[model samples]
Target: MPEASFSRGAHHPPTATASTAAASTAAAARGPDGPGAGLLGSLAPLLAEWLPRQRWFAGKGRPVTGFALVSATEILPSPPGGTTPGLLHLLIRAQQPEPPGHRHGFGCGHRRGAAASDCYQILLGVRTTLPPSLAPALIGRPSGGPLDGRTVYEALADPRLASILLERLRVPGRLDPLRFVREPSSAIPSILPPRLMTAEQSNSSVVYGDTFILKLFRRVSPGTNPDLELPLALARTGCTRVPAPAAWFEAAPPPEGPGPRPEPFTLGVLQPYLAGSTDGWQLALDALAVRADFTDAAHALGHATAEVHLAMADALPVSVLRRPQIEHLAAAMSERLDSAAAAVPALQPYRGALHAAYEDVAALGRTGRTWAAQRIHGDLHLGQALLTAERQWSLIDFEGEPSRPLAERRRPQPPVRDIAGMLRSFDYAAAVGGHDTPQDWAGGMRAAYCAGYAEASGTDPRDEPELLRAHETDKAVYEVLYEARHRPDWLPVPMTAIRRLAAAVR
Candidate 1:
């Protein structure tokens, strides 16, 4: 999914009084057999069956053994009149039954019997009758219990409810555990129609009349989300290459075992929407289709990337990767390479060379030459970039790779890692455009990008050849596994890179 893409719209009368009463009634029936049983106990079986079917669910191959409710709140009560459509915001913990010895590839960190669970954010629209427009988003009707015979569907798919959500965000207030906080300088209008962006894989978005876009994160983790954090930091550094954050919503997780404390988990973010902007992925494909020289665009994108990196370095904490940290990074890459080789048979042939690429980086670290590290766009690709109508590049999606742990994604890393990601994206475009056999166009674009980065940041990525090669190789290994699992037809794209890199190593 393009990082900046995807959202829903209407205004209901002031129904706070009616909503409060409805909320009270719903809360009162939260037992095993009451009208709210579906919200508590009965929703698990339904979610277990439904979640696996979602494209965003990461635990597709694993069986969901049980569900633990992290928190549940009635964000909106049944609208005025006799119509009963309540919007409920939920944070659910899905328990996965562990296989004896399974290790997921691409640094997913999935291990047997190790907290085998994932947290998901679900916005459910509950109603007695299914609307024809919303029938596609239907989760399923409960067989029995509090919500028996009632339909529950993804609420973000409903434009009316999505507009209501926008109004709620426009007014800064706390809804118990859920708090809507707006940027102090934001000037968003109160009534903009909303439209759902349907191309997203890991999140739901609502675009508000081309004014702002709200992204509701699907899988959530504790602490401030980097998607919000990084953009805010970049804005503070006076970086116009990223859209400024307008508003965000977060909820305090319910207390856990003894002495539970309140820690906020970011649920969604609102940012100024760039209407008519084209994503870099599509832009590259278009350029490739016509065999247009993409060197200028690639160079401009590199400058934008370097600008963001410089801004991040100025706004966030920076560190030097000493021997131990460098070794650890190399080790992690080696581990991912091993896991990818095990998962993709095509990668096995190149494992030795890939292992050597990681070793070369480790050997460089042993030479006592420390590299600068700072927060970066950890999972940068063409899809994460946007070219505005002004023909300028803008970066998005600082949440990093979804598979890695939040702490790991937030950790400082060499900027070349991002540079390597973009280079790989260029290769992907070339391959998909039928130019992989001669890769000269992609190679020229890559060199131009590095030149632009050096011109902007005063540090040529090519100066660190070993580190760059290793990072690129690591990213390709990850692609091999990802494509093998999710997109088997695209497996050859990364396999080409693997073969070329292996030949170079030999």
Candidate 2:
């Protein structure tokens, strides 16, 4: 798959997420200009305009997207930060749709849904030096509020101007300047306040090999970034599937009584670059290109996925939610289903069928033992896995759902959630992507993966049928909603799964 451009490239959803980075040698060989000032100038406005429209933009991109530079400092003396500022932070603001119904058509011709209204920081991750005009844009500094109302970072234009700007900051010796957020704990640490974007989210600048990714975390409820926490915990447990962590950095304010106390917040993680790795989606696509080989590979992927989940259960600590009475589940389902039914008129026709499945799953939960769940790969999707040409599947990105609170994301849920996620991925691969003729492989692969999960976790398949089925059904429902909203073209993938589930139950 072709890579999306710059920091605007990667996207993970609320309660879910998505990284890689190469070096300068390869960067120079890149097709486009990459993300630069002129790039920023043109791209910035585009981002300001487009970000709000994206579902991933969190609560309507920007609510206000603009820029204000606080300070820019250069680490290297001679070479200025790439074509952008060495250390640049810009505060941004744009309009967002007023919540749900409060919105009225007020923008453009028709109302622009909810538009971002206020502006904040737009931190720059300029490679080497800070740009000149950019400094004037910093907002919320000790000085307070966004400086100049300039919408874009102008510093990227002059290399020398960017240099002097980078020299201004006083980084703490104890802190990693590159680290930016605590959600994805592991990240590439830039100089203190690397490049600040006064936007409404916390982001991580991670360089995983030749692929440089900036993961955006919208909701922040302090502590270690889950991105780092989950992977490291898994690594500590000696889990081999995930992409290994190379380096870590977090930003913290300089300590008291000392010179400059370091900021303790983690912003990003720098990982070992996986240059030409393909995600599971592409991997499956490739495998299906050769019908026979697809089964074996799918089976292996299923095995790997199951192993990862099992290892995950054993590795991270978990918490169990009090089992809700069957009625409670019915109520929740009723609400969700009602909304879904309204959204997709066809669902209203199957309301009875769907409710029956939810009740069964709820009963299973009621009778089963819920545990203090361990940390799970919250957003377990095929896109999260990396496949090398050698065919080794590398599980990556432990950051849980990007939408939920960090603590909630870290909280343990049914281990089945992850398994269901993978299963859904398999169907998604075959149904959505052009990976046909692997129907048998997909079925057999599911069995193998499930079996492997039981074997590794030592949890008997017979012991958790209810939980397993419930999870699968839940995932199927979720997938249906997801596809309906995001990939309407592929809505049938999950809908078929749900209908299949309904039939099986019937």
The number of the candidate with the highest TM-score is 1
Residue-by-residue lDDT tens digits, candidate 1, 1-506 = 00000000001111112112122222332433333433444465677678888878877888776555556678877643337688888877666655434565433434434546677899999887878989899988765445666788999988878987898889989987789999988998988989999888877788999999999988887778899999999998899999999999998865543555545889999998999999998988888887777889989888899999999999999999988988999999998888777777778878898889888888988999799999999999999999998888999888898777787888899999999999999899888877644478778989998998998999999998889989999999989988998899998888888887777767
Question: Which pairs in model 1 have colliding backbones?
Answer: 7-195, 7-196, 7-197, 7-205, 7-206, 7-207, 8-194, 8-195, 9-159, 35-146
Candidate 2 lDDT (Cα, whole model)? 0.49
Candidate 2's residue-wise lDDT over 143-262, tens digit each?
111112223333323334333233221122332233322223344333322232243233433222243333433323235767777666667777777755544444332233435642
RMSD per model, one decimal: 7.6, 12.3
Candidate 2 local lDDT, residue 234: 69
